[model samples]
Target: MTETVRIATLDGADSFDAYVAWPEGTPRAAIIVIQEIFGVNPGIRAKCDKWAAAGYLAVAPDLFWRIERGIELDPDVEPEMQRAFELFGLNKPDDNVKDIEATIHWIRREAGVPKVGAVGYCLGGKLAYMTATRTDIDASVGYYGVMIDQMLGESHAIAKPLLLHVPTADHFVDAEAQAKMHEGLDGHPRVTIHDYEGLDHGFATESGNRRDEAGAQLADSRTAEFFAANL
Candidate 1:
């Protein structure tokens, strides 16, 4: 089951319209699922439900709520991509961090789970990195995160366990950039980076044409293992 909820931001504003999903009994952990540029669409919500089914209390906050409420995108459309980018371009990374922090606080306070972890996709993957830096999450998983190199420059602030899933063929993230990200995280013993071959951005979403069944299965298995180990 799922319910729409609101969370208060650090700046004393209503920051998100989020969905909470869990079973009837107590949860093992609370998970914060961040959305891609498309906002909190059906795919992300499904992911939250999957986590809930796996015995977690899952919450997916609408990160793009600052720009517009209930904005959703068709993953295959160029126009929708443009609109999503336009909305995301309006906010700075610091703003996203604040919003994410607020979401974390909401989960910790309201979800009633003793431990918390995070998972994110696309733009959310970057936010997962940011969440590790700013929040007290036990674990985090990022799927096909862009701008990881930019986040690596501040790796000193990250201390939690992080799993970054990258696609070999993703245009936004090339081999050289991935190498830099690995090098920057050299001393971070808690970080694990995995590269999935023959996959592109949004490979975990079944609705996307580039979705690779094998790669998605491997990633999902590893992600669940990572959370189990850390959370």
Candidate 2:
């Protein structure tokens, strides 16, 4: 079943809503689903539900709550995309990491799940990578993260398993950036990188015209296996 819950931030200065889904019985693990620039929309919620059906306790925190709660934006809408970017700019990377840290704390306080990990898409993808280098999560998966090349310096800080899904054709991550990322993370024992040859940015987003269903399925299956093994 799925429900909405309020969780406090690291400083407890404010609380944000997180869409949560639970497995039939006790969860084998817990997964934090970070949102794209679109916020906690249907896609993010569906991801949580799918994870729950797979026997993990899943939660997607409202990262955009500090700007506006319950934000559901369409990528095709220029104004909405603009708003998403505006909010993105205002929320520092450190802030996002703190919210995720608080989420980890909240989950540990409220649930008895054996392990916790995270999976993120688009903007959340970068957050997931940051989570790996900064937080205490067991594992993390990032789907075509942006500006990850710049953060590769922290790759050595990753003590937990990390999986990265990169679409070769993604405009946000050009060949140069991808090459840099691969150079930094490819041979690391704890890191796994998968590249889809011709997929575009947001290719895993079910609603986008650029979505590559087959690729998404394959990446998702790999993610499931990675989480099952590491978490």
Candidate 3:
């Protein structure tokens, strides 16, 4: 089953919408589906339903609600892509992370779900990494998370398991950044970085031209396995 829900922020003055999906029976765990630059659009909601099919309750929050009530962009459209970048530039990720924290707390307190994990793509991917380091999320998966090399200092706080999918050919994250990420996090016991040779960003998206079937399946299987083991 799928439904729309409202999540309360920590400050109590703000509340945002979230799209939720549930399995037929009791969920084994709860998975927070973080959105990319696009808001909780069809692709993101589809991901939540996919997790539901896998016996995990899933929710996708509208993190962009801070800047705009609803934002759904198409990567293939030039204008939308420009808007997405603009939204990305204007987005306050730190504040959005707090919304994720609130969502985690909501799942635990209201839904009675003790184990909660998160998976994200694009900008969501970066947030997932931040979630791992900042919050008590049980497990986190980031697919081609951008700008992660810039935040290696906080890696020390990552107590739970984190799976990062790195596309070696990602233009957004060049060789130097990837090298820096590896140098800082490769040996960390709680972190695992999987490199997809010759692939680029968005290869694991649920739909669109960016989706590479083989690469998506490989990365997704790894994500599923990682969540199963850790969450």
Candidate 4:
């Protein structure tokens, strides 16, 4: 089951709307699932449910709550894509990090989990990387994050285990950016980067046409392994 919950931030703002899901027993770990530019839609909700079933206290927050609540995109439509870009472009990465931080705090305290992990996709993937650097999460996984190159310069400060899943044919993130990410992660003992060939962005979203079952399975296996090892 899921419940809408509110969380307070370091900036003295009450600005997060989150969907919290827990397993039948005490959670072994907690996870903060961040959303894509499409907001907290069915795909993200499914991810939260999946994590909870995997024995985690999973929570997915509507990161766009600062701008609008429940603003989701129809991935099959170009107009909806354009509108999503327009709305998301109005917010900066810092704003997204604040919301993520608030969600993390709630997961650790209110969710009653001893340790926490995070997983994100697309824009949420970038936020996952930022969350690792800026928060005290035990582990973080980012899938096809477009802004990874932009954040590479700050990766040295990351102290937790970070797993990045890249699609070889992603339109938004190219080969050169993947090379930059590798270089940024160089010598970081806790960082693992994997590239799946013939996969595109949104490979794990079952509702999207780009979803590749094989790629998503591999990513999910690797992500679970990473979280098991780290969290």
The candidate that achieves the highest lDDT relative to the unseen native structure: 3
| Higher-ranked by TM-score: 1 or 4 | 4
**In model 2, where do residues sit more than 4 Å from their true spots?**
none
Q: What is the lDDT of residue 119 in candidate 1?
A: 92
The lDDT values for all models are: 0.83, 0.91, 0.94, 0.85
Best candidate, TM-score: 3
**How high is the lDDT of residue 113 in model 1?**
70
Candidate 1 lDDT by residue in tens digits, 1-231: 899998888877555688889866888888888888888888888899999999999988877776788888876889998888887788566777787778777877766676889999888888899888887788899899889898786677778899999898888788888788878875688788888876788888746775788889999999999999888
What's the lDDT for residue 204 in model 4?
84
Compute the lDDT for candidate 2: 0.91
Candidate 4 runs further than 4 Å off: none
Give the Å error, residue 230, model 2.
1.0
Error of 3 at 156 (Å): 0.3
Question: Where does candidate 3 clash, by residue pair?
Answer: none
If the candidates were sorted by their lDDT against the true structure, best first, what order would they fall in? 3, 2, 4, 1
lDDT for model 1: 0.83
Looking at candidate 3, what is the lDDT of residue 83? 95
Candidate 3 lDDT over residue span 15-91, tens digit each: 99999999989999999999999888888999999999999999999999989987898888899989999999999
Model 3 lDDT on a 0 to 1 scale? 0.94
Candidate 3: deviation at residue 168, Å? Answer: 0.6
Candidate 1 C-alpha error for residue 180, in Å: 0.7
Which scores higher on lDDT, 1 or 3?
3
Query: Model 2, residue 14: what's the lDDT?
Result: 89
Residue 59 Cα positional deviation in candidate 4, in Å, after optimal superposition: 0.6
